[model samples]
Target: NSSVSCHIVQVFSNSDEALINKKLPKELLLRIFSFLDVVTLCRCAQVSKAWNVLALDGSNWQKIDLFNFQTDIEGRVVENISKRCGGFLRQLSLRGCLSVADASMKTFAQNCRNIEHLNLNGCTKITDSTCISLSKFCSKLRQLDLTSCVSITNHALKALSEGCRMLENLNLSWCDQITSDGIEALSRGCTSLRALFLRGCTQLDDAALKHLQKHCPELMTINMQSCTMLYPSCSKSQMTALWFVCLAAATSQITHTHTESFIHIACVFLRILEAARCSHVTDAGFTVLARNCHDLEKMDLEECILVTDNTLVQLSIHCPRLQALSLSHCELITDDGIRHLSSSVCGQERLQVVELDNCPLITDITLEHLKSCQHLERIELYDCQQVTRAGIKRIRGLIFNFIGCCVILGVNCVLFC
Candidate 1:
């Protein structure tokens, strides 16, 4: 009986040794596993209780991209992580996490106000109420992406501008309901605004830009691309001087048009221009850009219907070192413009990246000419019906896979097998 008891004890001792002694130190294990991609790292969580804790810790969580782990099940998991992480989060990305409602957003905003980067793209359930709450709670907002948050109105922006004055980078893109009034308010309030993307905010017009020029002087980058209403071409030459003054006066009679005109005339300087969807902007407005902003790099003349090939033919002649140009949706641009671009001063080399999205006029003939460009890295041809598959056959393909199926297609912006 004593011998039988000794044998059982020996078996148990061996089992404990095999289970615990060979286990790796948690710190060492996490250090080794942190290099793995999100998928492989997530698998580590299922290994044991120790691993699950390590994987969800702030150190490892910082690198794990939330954009990839986007499923109905993962929403609750991420929220739980937010609650567990306390205040250690530096960058929080909840992009495309549809289940994260206003309450979850408020919880995050209130807790993670110290976040250096926050991406709330496609979080449709988030309304102006969330923004109002964030204004009071999140004062350290630097980089914010409110893209596709359709419910955000002027009230939300007003709240943010009044409170989050430290905001340097803001993307209000695709918030179509936003008007020039909201933009004017932001321009006046967020004086430190560096980069503001007003893309697809159709209600923003010339009045907004005029306001920005007056108030947001420190603005380095502005993306008004596809802002169809603000198309400078739509505004009459007379409105360039009259509309802004009239609107400002109507609001508060701050300064009369004639008085502002005299001041502008004394110091003739019109620096920034982004007349992408403005079908009315003729060579006249472009001539103003060519004269001023000698250091101007970005020019988006896409879908400016009045801007014929002749306009570009002149712009290339004047703006020699133009770096980024997007001539998307400009159906009128022909080989004449492309040929001029191929040989002119602002030709391939001086130009770094150019977007020819939906410009049917550009074929392989133009693309082949563009291949001569040295620094050109990205070329967006999303809906360009004319570009055949042969155009980008040589470029290496990257797949944005979601679990098993790909959602964003690929470089060409079309369905891929």
Candidate 2:
């Protein structure tokens, strides 16, 4: 309340204008203005030229968070702030700033050379020109989010890789224009890169994976959801069925051909892999993944209908540290597949979260198989019609609340306790 009163007096000085101005030093006034939000600071700037200068000081604009004012942030507003911030800005988040265009981004890139974190998520108007400017100026950038920036192509990625080698985390999800070439260039240049989100990038194939395997040794997380072209075949169901049929005869041959080269390179640090809806990834592809990515802790294979018990068995045998696994909508998986997973060393000792949502074929027997999994915490069986309340009740450490035949289990049950 006292702070609000002081701010009011600082702005609306009446007969005591001279007294208030003489009493508070400029340094003290600037410090007080620093505590105010951007909107409040803008209001203070309207009071007087002295207050305007202090409110719009470079120190006050070091980290401009426009997320709260997403609807209000326009190209002119960002451009004006960039002009004022000069070189002092370190973090700028314009997430969902629909009106932000390439010109504003260009101005920000030119002025804020020291910016380390920039979030331009859903900024549809931005093009490759912004990326070109950023690559030329923002060399210290560590985290960049260009999610849903559809116009961004390989040219922008090439520029970024050549310039911002310090980039650690990048989210390129929904950037459909990107391909293996740009990803390869990035991996080759940004050796320190750790987490990459390529979800919905349909153009990326095994070639991109090979590039990451060869270059990014420190890479830990990769999300390739909806990348249907990663495999050689177009029809995921037929290709997977063929792979499963030939699995016995071709396991050694496929492993020798595909995994021998980069198996060691990938097995070291790769931890999390989410390839949901990538239908082309069959047992052969998953075999290479399971064999190489031994340190994989979390994996999501949602809607990957081709994956059979063989892949789960391989994951169980190879990835002893495996903890979280999601096989949602994978119609091919049966109790036999889950039994293999539960019997595995990792499943018995370390597996914690398991999501089998929409897996229609899974019965109560599947839950019975999981009794030996002492470390098991949470199991999601949403829409699994075959699993009855009595079957779910048999599992120890999982207590269900039966409310009119609807079995609801607390998410916190045994998992956190």
| Top-scoring candidate (TM-score) | 2
Instruction: Kindly list the per-residue Cα lDDT of model 2 for residues 166-258, writing each as its tens digit.
Output: 998899988999999999989888878877888778787767866766677666556665665553221111111010001111111223233
In model 2, the Cα lDDT at residue 37 comes to 79
Tens digits of per-residue lDDT, candidate 1, 1-417, equal 999988766644553343432576667766776677667767866656666666666666553357775565244565676676646666777788777677776776676666667787887877888787668877877778889999889988899888788888888888989998898777777877767887778788667767666676566566665665542222212212211111111111112232233223211222334544555456655555455434445666666665557767766777777777778777777756777765766665576666777777766566556555555545666666666666544322322211122112236464321
Off by over 4 Å in 2: 1-37, 40-53, 184-191, 210-217, 231-265, 279-292, 336-340, 343-345, 372-377, 394-417
Runs in model 1 lying further than 4 Å from the true structure = 1-38, 73-75, 226-228, 231-277, 295-303, 308-313, 323-343, 348-417
lDDT against the true structure, each candidate: 0.62, 0.74
- Candidate 2 overall lDDT versus native: 0.74
Compared with the true structure, model 1 gives a TM-score of 0.64
Error of 1 at 92 (Å): 2.0
Cα misplacement distance, residue 185 of candidate 2 (Å): 4.4
Per lDDT, the best of the predicted structures is 2
Estimated TM-score for each candidate: 0.64, 0.74
